[model samples]
Target: MENGNKRLAVLVGCNYPNTPHELNGCINDVLAMRDVLVKRFGFDHSHIELLTDAPGSLVMPTGANIKKALDQMLKKAEPGDVLFFQYSGHGTRIPSAKPGHPFRQDEAIVPCDFNLITDVDFRQLVNCLPKGASFTILSDSCHSGGLIDKEKEQIGPSSVTNDGTLQQSCSPKTIPFESILQHLTSQTNINTSDIGTHLLELFGADASHKFHLHPNELDLSESLKTDEGILLSGCQANETSADMNPMMTGGKAYGAFSNAVQMVLKDHLGSLSNKEVVLLARKSLEAGGFAQHPCLYCTDENADAPFLWQPQGSDL
Candidate 1:
């Protein structure tokens, strides 16, 4: 069943092997997602870009490489096309540099090389998408709930449990600010307290534009109102997603949220709505004793929209 519209995807998983921020299951998460896209959703294999930090990987999941892949996908996007981005890695929260920023903190995904891609970067990307195009992001990482800045919250802390209790047995996939500062300090030999300055020095022009913006110029109204982007975050902004190893799952290592989504999709016969998927996944996580709550950020219309386009529809 081929949908008339084109489908493209960028999948990134950073295991950060042998590093202080190492994880046991990111690579496996994205690989499983790749299969799901191709086999279940009819996404062409050639149109999908895969990036990882696994040994001998052709393209590393560095910040520069990830941005380039996303740009390429957007360039190839036409109205009515479907685009997807999946990140299974460590996500960090940095104190907002701009004075009086509403959120007070900026959420980011950690690349293999430690160059961070912040929420603003994703907002800009969503703004660039063609009018009739749709871009769905599945971020299976900690502090990922608001990764796409200012998107409407269809399902979030208000609708779910906001108790902020973390399961003691679960391994969280977040890199602390101190760890990031230490790593960047070692790399650039600069002991500055500001993460933005360290990012500017290390990546130069390639660093996130968020770090370079003047405080007074930080208006995101346009990016806030986008109808083309949908985000399914692994956990609430204040919660940590679990990294499940074989010892915990008695099988292959993987992200608890990622595995929960896969299970929901597999158990269903027809396509589930975006909101339905999150609700079901949240249930699965709760049943498994994991504390992280999956969230969906998108418009009300998208909340009812079928997850990524149905296998037999032209809506993509």
Candidate 2:
């Protein structure tokens, strides 16, 4: 069933344990996605891998497991291979352990065990790939956009103090900028520069305490000039993507973006480009009255190309 010219794809999803919410809510979506790729898109099932929270399977997304998977892919993947990485779960920012290091914070994807695959690990994985292999990463979780923040905005409102001095008011709803600065300053344990540098590269320079737009305008194709990578995030760095109850739709919960992706790939299989896919998905969500923006951040110059899957009779 292999298509000699088709690319490989690896999909991963996670739902945490012991939490009221399930971590693998989107596992089915990923499975469905893989099916579409294989049956309609010309991909070989052997070329597609799925990792999830299913029992007795590969341990759910530990840092080591992520690395192991990457290593496996690197070994088998060759130039011109189109690689896709999809993740659905929680995202966090942890304080760094040392001072003067690049990152004062660390970003992560929460695994089933509550451990994380830090951004540091991701960068290393990306850097290790062979040139000319294209990567399209889709992350459905909070802070996914941290991989692309560029501008800075004050998180809390500014107020006038008693002495007529403009000061930031401390309130339960307001996050103080100083708190973030202080957290960054308190590191004395682990070296965090590399993590910090990676954070800045992914989330932008002002990621400390300010919410900023993800630097999404980067020419994905240009950055990976060797024809290798692209990124499509669920939300901007400063925003949170919703994970709603799937049972409401006669199933379990799924992130809003995940649901939309399924809709497009299933309904409009042959006639849409990635850009059209994103637009339709966004419109569908908005028409349903969801107040979220399903954004598409692509580093791939050819991101506008037609989808890999298309119905018969479609022009190639």
Candidate 3:
């Protein structure tokens, strides 16, 4: 399974256009990631698939479209291939289906069409990969630390902060949940039909649907104990990721966590391990006056693996 193979990637970014929850920098975040993957990671331009909310784009970052893109990326995966999935968007939580989860809320990524993809959905995707193919995931959104439902955490913040929010950003002008609802409401044409659908799916959908509640029935730990997939999350499940004006570049907006990752990668040039990336990104965020901390989720052995490990591959 370790034979030489090419690289593939899927990148998604959403800025919730013309809505109350509009973010300014997600598209820019994805563009930055594309740059690093092309210039530094040895990925060919033809092999990368980008889905964003930018104008004149062929693909949009809706739930169905995102799932389809991921399926395409995984369908052709092979041994020694470098597979990557990157998301720079809003992340939220809904009521957990399991009583075992203390917070009673399951983490999800906010897509353009409001089909909210959950952690279980991502875990299912990770499970589909072959043993020798390295699948690396980077999520630059709030509450994304647990997007791969049952993945082991090697570095993270305290789970005790489970109020489904960040105390630092709970100001009167920035209530994220309220903003999310307002954005969803804007999509409804006349009646409250869209919101009703969201409520129905959140409260009444069958377990087979992707938007269903936390149906984490699989033993992801044992299944992926030695798997090569790794996740670098923007924050803990209870925190918020910031979309600040890019003071460093001073033009477009960018997610703090995404910018930090690119910064670390540029500085280290593949010398850092997965845990080192998280720690360095944490320090970078703190230095930039951000409250959220980056996190790393992988098995113990993979924690020491290179940031985006590839079989028999070396980097600059």
Candidate 4:
């Protein structure tokens, strides 16, 4: 018995308020993506939840709150259901915990309260989806290239074509790196080391110890291993996503990668394959003057699957 008819989305964005890591565009990015799900995609308004750091939002984008929201989203999921998750925030790399994993680091999404959500955590959440269902996640953050470890590398900084051969290789970025570049270029009182130290202070000494406190050390592990999940990341494991100011939005801000994704879907009608979307978003971001690259991660056979593809029970 499958329930392929329902479409559910959980959108999370965090702009740490009054904090040194405060960002201006993350919340805006989620809002725009949410609108796309409601208008262009088939996701219903009722089934969509917005979790952000904005004051008085229905739910805050804390680690615990986010986990709780995902639990709720998975409550009624069944085979053939389509699940969508969009996260626009800061991403970091720390030590790896996988069995026999060689790397000293793994990728994680930074929650509002400084509680880090590691790649292992995401793997668990992904496994919760019904066997026939699909979990599609878009992570717009730094060091986000391999957020779901051990997933196939379909389209990355180095692309894998339908024949499984490498095609083009490019740069990495942030929903993950935008603010990083912004700070580096703005001539502000902050430097990379300064910000790194600030993160230590903000997130506390325990988080620093758990993560080994080695910020920006990205490692891609093939050793560790999940559900039928597709990941669209803003940049490579070493690169950061751009949190850019929207030129047309009158001082408003948005994530560089998220904005590119929105442009690709908004300008085109109907659906596009995963490869197509990643390619288009790359072109759009490059044209817009952002160096951060986007990548797609899925099984080799699913490389050509449509973005946010509706689950077909028979295929499972």
Candidate 5:
């Protein structure tokens, strides 16, 4: 399954951690995804990497580990390579400190140690990739939808569960670290400026005037922008994505959106377009009685175009 062109994947799931709402199934979900890509999509074992909390000789990825993984991928990736990054865990949004900041908040991926993987850092990483390469990122966790847009809708408070009790808490707010440090350091960089511009566009004129709060919304168009890439998120900014229930089977009970994606990959591999895949995933989730909606954000004009995973002799 090895292709001369380098194709690397970094699958990360942080379940056993110092965070609220511990997960029981995200690791299984990542493993399932690895299997799907390797067996069905012709990915080589050497080309793909899985970083999780699974027992029995598994490499766990942390803050430094994550940086190393990304660096390795970038080092080996060619122009045509396709890099896939899948994360299952928590996300947060903090408030920005600058008064005239365009964005009202900063978004981040919550690591195992409760440290933040800021979007500014992510943007720097993305920009470093070879021009012709493409990236596909799938995130299943709270506040992930905001990674793409400042005005991204926040998930309603009703969807989350705390201490076995269903709770209705809106998504958390985030401010860029640069904004926080600007006051202390009195210095700035291009990355900070870009983030500020995006934040302003999302929060609008009131970004600097006041702290405006809203429901979580995922901006697929802004996040998944690339001529050849796609971004698939578990839920909208305002929606809650569930952890696995031990009572369920098929690895671990997945978030409704992740579950639907697994179903599409399993049952309809080659017979659906990216849009169709998302539609089917949504239908499956609703049929299973999920209350929130799953979202598929992509910048590729052909995102809605037909794509099928057909087996030999299968009808297209």
Candidate 6:
């Protein structure tokens, strides 16, 4: 049975407080995105699930918690529904687990507790949505391009370097693979060279499904001609997103890409298409002297569809 079209969102921000991977702008990005969804997109505040790493937050943005929240939201979703997910945190790339995949590295998001959610997980989630529904993801983190596996890329990398190689000093939003491995080893005292083993031991079944994939299931030849996943990545898979601290923003911290998207939204009077939003955001970042380039991934039709399914002339 098709439920009436509803606006649903899952917003997550991880600061990784007091840790080596601590960020300064992620929580602020979530709060800001949430406000826009309610005020501009007409999303009911009650329908939005917010998870952050800030102190006193009721639900922390752990890997399991985030997956559970997204699962529940998708469960209630039906045809004509509009679903949105905003992630603000560090991003990383790891060698592909998929056998014979073209891309050497797969993109992933870092949760507050160091659990990573990979592109394969996102692709699975998007595949579960009903035919008429849309799931849009705004990832304000480094190495975020292609976060949705197999989705068509409307805007792609320009000068991205080889996979798994990132400029860390310029991109604080990127947490290196070595750093994550060291942290896990320190905590678990497991002397395995493979990071996947440590993640499996720490998170077990809750670990990223990429860790347990069978070699037979590694084919990437399937087409996404019928998929409805949209991704607004902060940068190319090999590039990094910038985190604007209080010192830089002169007040509240913010993910550079998140702030750019907000600025584009606020400046436009009517609803903008997905392609328009990403293009404007790219311009905004370039104007601000940020080297990061935001990219969009979705079907050709979705590239022209109104963002969040909001109609034309809808007020922002």
Listed per candidate, the RMSD to the true structure in angstroms reads 3.0, 10.8, 5.1, 8.1, 9.7, 3.7
The best-first sequence of candidates by TM-score reads 1, 6, 3, 4, 5, 2
Q: What is candidate 5's lDDT per residue for 1-316, written digit by digit as tens?
A: 1222555788887775433445666777788888776766556788777777655535665555666687788788887667778887766566654345546665566555443455544544565667667556677765565453322222212343323322122222222345433422333232444433443444343232112222232222243434444456665555556665646333344554666788887786465665676667656756665544555554444365333222243331
lDDT tens digits by residue: candidate 1, 1-316: 1233899999999888987678888999999999889888988999999999999999999999999999999999988889999999999899886677656877899999889999989988999988788899999999999998889998888455444444444578899988999999998888788888899999998899788887665574487564779999999998889987766547787899999999998888687999999999998888887778899998888899888886764332
Task: Give the Cα lDDT of each candidate.
Answer: 0.87, 0.52, 0.73, 0.70, 0.55, 0.86
Clashes of each: 0, 19, 0, 17, 38, 0
Model 5 stretches astray by more than 4 angstroms: 1-4, 17-20, 55-58, 97-103, 146-229, 248-251, 305-316
TM-score between model 4 and native: 0.75
TM values, all candidates = 0.93, 0.65, 0.81, 0.75, 0.67, 0.92
Q: 1-316, model 3: which lDDT tens digit per residue?
A: 3543878999998987786667878888889888878777677899999999887778788887898888888888876777899998888866565546656666788787766777877877788886678777899888888878778888977543222232232211122554555655665433443333554444344222443433464332345556766889998887778887544555567788888988888787545788898999887877766778788888887798776553334454
Whichever of 3 and 4 has more TM-score, that candidate is 3
Model 4: CA > 4 A from native = 1-3, 99-103, 159-226, 246-249, 310-316
Cα deviation at 52, candidate 5, in Å, is 1.3
lDDT of 2 at 48: 77
Candidate 6 wrong stretches, greater than 4 Å: 1-4, 101-103, 159-171, 220-225
Which pairs clash (backbone N, Cα, C closer than 3 Å) in model 6?
none
| Candidate 5 accuracy as lDDT | 0.55
**Candidate 2 to truth, TM:** 0.65
Order by lDDT, highest first:
1, 6, 3, 4, 5, 2
Candidate 1 TM-score, C-alpha based: 0.93
Candidate 5 vs candidate 6, TM-score winner: 6
TM-score of candidate 6 relative to the true fold: 0.92
- lDDT by residue (36-71, candidate 2, tens digit) is 676666667888777777666756665446546666
Give per-residue CA lDDT, model 4, range 182-270, as digits (tens): 44335434454433344444444423232443333323322233357788998878777777654554566778788788888778676
